[model samples]
Target: MTDDRFLYDPDTAVDPLGDAEATRAAGRSSKHNYAKVGSGRPSSLLYNYGPGAIMDLPHFTVMSTGLDDWERMWRKRVDSPPEIHAPRLREVVAKLLRSRNVRLRPHPNQPRKTGLSREGNDLGVPARVFPQWMRCTGCDLLAPLSHFGYTNTHPYRPDQARFEHERCPGRSGSRSGKNASRAAVPARYLLACVDGHLDEFPYDQWVHHWSPCPKVEFPVLRMVDRTAGKGASAVIHCATCGARRPMNEAQGDAGRSKLPRCRGRHPHLDAFELNGCGDATRLMLVGASNLWFPMTQSIIVMPRSANEETSDLAARIRVAFASKPHRLEKYEATGDLEGLRDALDGKLDGPVDEEAIPDDQLAKALGEALTSGESDEDLAKWRADWDPVDLLVPEWNYLLTDPLGLGHEDEASGLTLSHRDRAPGLRKEIVRVLAVERLRKVNALVGFTRIDDVDRVADLSQRMVPLARAARPAWTVATEDRGEGIFLQLDEPAVAAWEAQVEQDQLWLAHRAAHRRNFESRTSDTAGPVDAEDRLRPPRYWLVHTLAHVLIREMALECGYSAASLSERLYAWPGSDGRPPAAGLLICTTAPDSDGTLGGLVQLSEPERLHRVVSSALYRAGRCSSDPVCGMRTPQDTEDFLHGAACHCCAMASETSCERANRFLDRRFLIDLPGSGIGFFGLPG
Candidate 1:
């Protein structure tokens, strides 16, 4: 059986703040050799440790290999990796990839047996030993992994997998001692570029300054740590020629010139770019958070109307026919299903999986595909047109209208919603309340970045590092989570009036200016010009975002759920081009399992209970132990900060809960800031 230590439980491994470093540290320090070493939840593969990411295991530092490697490895196993079904997310990713044929599969996780052998069962995502350099702990001997001896005492226990410096002589120069073979840890440092190329630290080059050793062709080296607190305390010394250099010398602005140009290497892929990247290399620690930042897109799965489903099916059918022009011509000539049926019988292959599709739906989709006259180019154009905001518009409409009504359930889509009456005393503010009894969320990892978290939808193409050596990937990795939530839509008229009132307020103006400055500062390093619209945030957004945080904090205390277990989705976009404005938030929790969290959150959506929660949340938002100072705080004159009248003690929610990462929030927008007249809610006597 695969050791329990190798399996990652999503519920336990993923940090609420989206940090995986702590979990990795736990795996590294595990006392049991059979304990999990590379264990993490399936969600981690989609967020914190996707392809090309460097991961620290108990016995080794490894890099998740490219999708090409994953495919090659999985092909060897009998069972294919499980596929995730989220049409909306698939459509978005298909558009991003500019390919109609795209699939979303999660990392392979086989069910464990008590006494099963690991032999011929290495069926998980593939990872390679990274950096390839190791430092012997006992003798300070530094060399490539080739020079070390490897051992896996328990083949079934991956945690016991380790590399050792077998012939190491201790500091006492005694080779026949128990300490002759010492454990080797990965070299602490690595090299990276903004372009996402990663390479081993240039230890030899750094020590010798790009010159050959004067004493020998290949010098023996030692990384000596002085046990001091700073990077300068670590020195790389050549034992052959006595050349030495401190690690701190390779940091900051001064260090950029000392390092070589990027070789455009993707160590995980074991390949290098034909024309190397021109970007300069920077020194990075192996465990630095900036070394890998996953670029992911996620969406809450919503039920589609019958017509909408038919339309999507028709599009897929058209894409299938577009690949086989002869079949399309035959169908167009006959104007019937005879040709399509023949093609289907012959096992036509395309985006539409024939096995999963029903005969009736296939027939209806075929009729629409032939009549719609959607050419291959037209289909491509349709797939190319996608907007991130557009994904939310349908969801917003569904929550408000509840056209499907209460007790509505779609087994295929995994969506179940029941519209509840508006809470008492909140009718004027909250227009609708929805008990989202069941919902599915799909998260997909497209690419990753080095040294920065670039998540702008528009700039994703330019900023994201490719997952494969090829220009495009055949598929991306994704995972599906099912859970429940509570949706609250604010009255648009009330929200509009409040926003108009705050638009001209001095405090709001200061926050807006800070938003602009923050955007400019972040985009300053990019080569492209910044869009003016990207710097602006409507007052409604700040109000809705802040209200969500306050509500989340209050809901966590009242409900059994912890603050980290809850997440908020804001629907705050201003009206433009004849579209209506939206002001709402959805507080929800989800898990990787089929049977989601117990309805602790959905139960709180009852009218009387919700009324109390909202009232208490607003009352709590107005006062804070850190108030007076926090209340007076504003983002004005601060280029980096984007929040005002918001701090950890009050408006800021956990990083996983707040969509903006705790930005664009202000208690002053939700409740009056001391003597200010800007609050959206007034306390009752």
Candidate 2:
């Protein structure tokens, strides 16, 4: 079935002949073939639903297949996917994955179809029906999809696709040969383990106690709702032998004892681990927010060379080569510039503006690509000493020092910056404000987790489950977003003095103790020895982090961009592991479109306007609608919560905007509250 709901472009078409090849490549059954079921923005694939993620469609519940399936589709020339290049992000992913030749490809996309015939627009990420079990709405008859008849009456409208119990004999056996078929819905509950294995809840075993039905070989099950509230009221009955059990028996602590162990099933891969997973399965609702947590890492594209022009030119050239690898290989083999130029000129197969590239710059970039080689030996050494914290250090230095003098706009690199003069009368705590006119951020989906999100945890490698079943994947999906931002740097001396004063405050100490307890509780299930540095946040971090959320809330009101469209990047550290103390935050908005949001955010960064905004934001932060209770609230000794004196009504930003998932935030750290002297900014007069 075709649906534009998930597609970036609804009218695009793929070659009809490629369908057979794609199906074979994906190793999917005829019923589970590709048909442009749905599509999503490239960015969504990174954060919301990458490979191995379960997605809910209008009429179906499906799980995105692994990278192996995606690669096969590309190999069959089903759709030509675009390659994204961000050197820093590439290096980080390489170290994380322990691979040298990893490629960053985005979701397949095509232009609108102009021809009369739209026979084949089936290009999209491959997916398979998950929780294969379905129940007939009319009769409450429960069975696998194979037992039901599927139909998609409108090929162009995926929402119309659905399953029907074509042979539904009505609620009672007496209504034989009656056409009482009704639409089928997926079973509400699923089974998952902390090890990241997901599978359909065991219906047959639950009713039969893991034993075969004594009276019949095949049991016909029915999930009958007793018209009562809660899951306990729902009953799974075996029509064959009359064996039955309530859905509640498969949930909670008691449920673990009643349910089967994880089968190590990765439905997306259409494969299972050889050895069964020993972890106990926990019952989870299908639409629960905690079902899938994407573990993605993104980086702002930065210039590699001291010369901005050279760096920009090189970036363009690399992108051009990445889209056409055969030409890149040909050039690498023959070392012929003329031949490469001729190939590029023959057809604008890649970026349309490639024809406008200067010959000198092209030659320079080609020379660098050939010489760099990107050897595995060098990568091995780099990975050996790699620290995730170091990723922010260079970015911190670049935003503050501006060592490369990158104040000019560069369209090729997608980086435009102009330093705004800080007013002498501006707040003393704020040291600098720079308008990031244009920026490119590349986000790559490395892995994901289920049950709990490891957003702030340092050793993500421990909990993160692979996208593909392979020990090593050749490439992962990624997308590049071009946007703008406002960078703010806090005064170091003032922040340091505040940090010193808060060190001995009882309230401050209580917050610290709360954090430690929270960290220990969260990581209690983790295997290895936990490091305090990995989970603990310094007081300086809380100050900058809380301030970012406050300013974001204020800016969103006037910036034309909604709060969800804005995002924050906090650069806070207390000079650890040879890295200097850093305190800053970037409030930015990005989009998949070529031209990002208008300059509303940057306009707010003007010294005069910024002073007003910060003053208002601080004034508002000092009091919340949920205050008295909110203002007085502290992370209790027994609770595992991270934030102190921060809630949705006050300092908390949307999940998309806050990098820490709204953790390590407190208005008391940013604005004065009652008797709290820990606030960095005084209440506005």
Candidate 3:
């Protein structure tokens, strides 16, 4: 293994929150970079410290001296703090009870050691029985508790799991309350395979720190390209400990997503620093989990005041209480937020203090926020609507964001090299992934052309109606600058110019052929009627596929997904929890000046890829000549192109380029930069 010291120089002192001059040094450097492409050692060794750094070091020695121990301690304390011992809790209870002077009324129905609330219910559960519950400070037995295993104060689900003294055993099943409480989070939070397969310990073990991450730092090896354009932050989990957390609260501190900014200084931050684990226990629980392992990064950080935590928790609880609940089943099944609201009855307006808001009304409001989804503004409406006394603390962020732990990179292997500009390439990969999906969808459209299966043809035929009128149609939302002026948007304006274009372009071959084969005999190679001599080939299909990709990309941009995120959203084609780049439909933008010089351009919305290639024909003249304008060029240029125009493909870009004019405009390719064009509009591109 390479010198561990190189990769983690805790001695230099790093302020991840940017308190000090944010230190940037190589966490580990190599004279010969095994992580690079040509390094003969193979990229897999990079996780094992490449040829220069240690990769697969067992986390057992994480508690060793220096920064590695600091990281280890940071992970353990942040993820799963040492389990509170029964005796220790009892002492705290004695102290608190002694100071408060409270008397408990005996209930005849309750068990011997079980404390009861006003209602005849168990108050505190033993850690063993309710795996999520805490140990009772006064009683040594498992009592029904309210805090563990998150509960909805009202009915968010059909099954009302909450009670005045509700007890729940989460993922860990228990025959008795005993087993649930004792099984604290395991020792190792992460599991990394030699092959680079990393697994997290458990979802529930993570503490969602609501704070903005300044920037990722590594003393030895910061990804050289991280300071480029803004993008969403990743959810990085510790490879050795499996402790996981998000790098930022809202897709990085950059205003990339629509979420409001979260405010707070790093609270759970380690007071000290530990670079690595010091022990070999793969899985251990209880405070004893720290016995062999040195408290490497233990800084003796001050605990947040009860007022701070309580107020924050109470505010979150209020938001949850003010939430509108909706049916999750339909939301997942249909992806219809409006329909989901209707099914759940949405949220009701007005006051709740009138003896008044019916339980069903409260349930409706909860469903509105849950199913319809809530905005930041929806959170402020907690006054007079919710009771802090009976609040349900939900993972509000989780419910709002599409998915959790997404975009997280690997730690051990250090999969993140200087590939910052690779997002466009990532978009291309996403498109490729989605293209396969579109092809898969063709299977459903197979064989629908035959006369008997002809009835089903109307389903697709109805789409043709809108297809016929697609050209020059007005769009709902308009982008500030139409990409038509530049080489990117002006290409191939007639992708779906009319109903006939689909057939003329053979856009539906896969789906049409697949659906056609389903019902009847395949007679015509063509599905719907089209112009003569058009054949389906790879180049031809790729051209259409590219068009489909363009459409998806345009729609994705409109739907609030950035070029960086296009690939993420399109890769999976989100059903509910996930957002698969929006390949649903496309929005066509027609520049008013498309009169032959740079005719119309077609933009596809919700494309499947991140880096989308828009093909617009250009000539030595520099005009974006698409469709009929192919005839505008002389027949001489036609000899080379078989149509006199050159097919020029560009990604999303702004401004126009003139190549043939006396003083030709040189199209400067903006390297890793997003877009170097002048003006604020070009900044985000």
Best by TM-score: 1
- RMSD after Cα superposition, model 3: 29.5
Off by more than 4 A, model 2: 1-34, 76-80, 111-120, 173-177, 226-229, 306-387, 402-407, 455-459
Task: For candidate 1, give the lDDT of residue 601.
Answer: 93
Please report, as a residue range, the 10-residue window in candidate 2 with the lowest summed lDDT: 1-10
* Residue-wise C-alpha lDDT for candidate 1, range 187-290, written one tens digit per residue: 88888887778899878888998888898877898999857446545899899999888888888999888999998887766666666777888888888888
Clashes of 1: 2
Global local distance difference test of model 2: 0.74
Shift in Å, residue 459, candidate 1:
4.1
Give me the displacement of residue 447 in model 1, in angstroms. 1.0
**Residue 511 accuracy (lDDT) in model 2:** 78
State the lDDT of candidate 2 residue by residue for 1-685, as single tens digits: 2111111221222232365556777886444433666667887777777776778888778778777667666655544355676767765785666543465787755545654445335446777777788888778888888988777645456677788888576777655547866788887778988867788987888889899998887789999985644655678999999998888877679778988888887666655666667788888877778888887778888655445444444444554565466667677677676777776563422233555667777677666644444566675566445665677887787787552344676654668888887776678888888889889888888888888776434446666777765554657888888889999999988888888887777867777778777767666354456565556677888998998898899998878999999999889887766798988899999988778778888888888888888878887888889979888888666876778889999899888898887888877878778867668886642
Go through the candidates in order and give each one's C-alpha lDDT: 0.74, 0.74, 0.22
Model 1, position 102: C-alpha lDDT score: 61
Model 3 regions more than 4 Å off: 1-500, 504-685
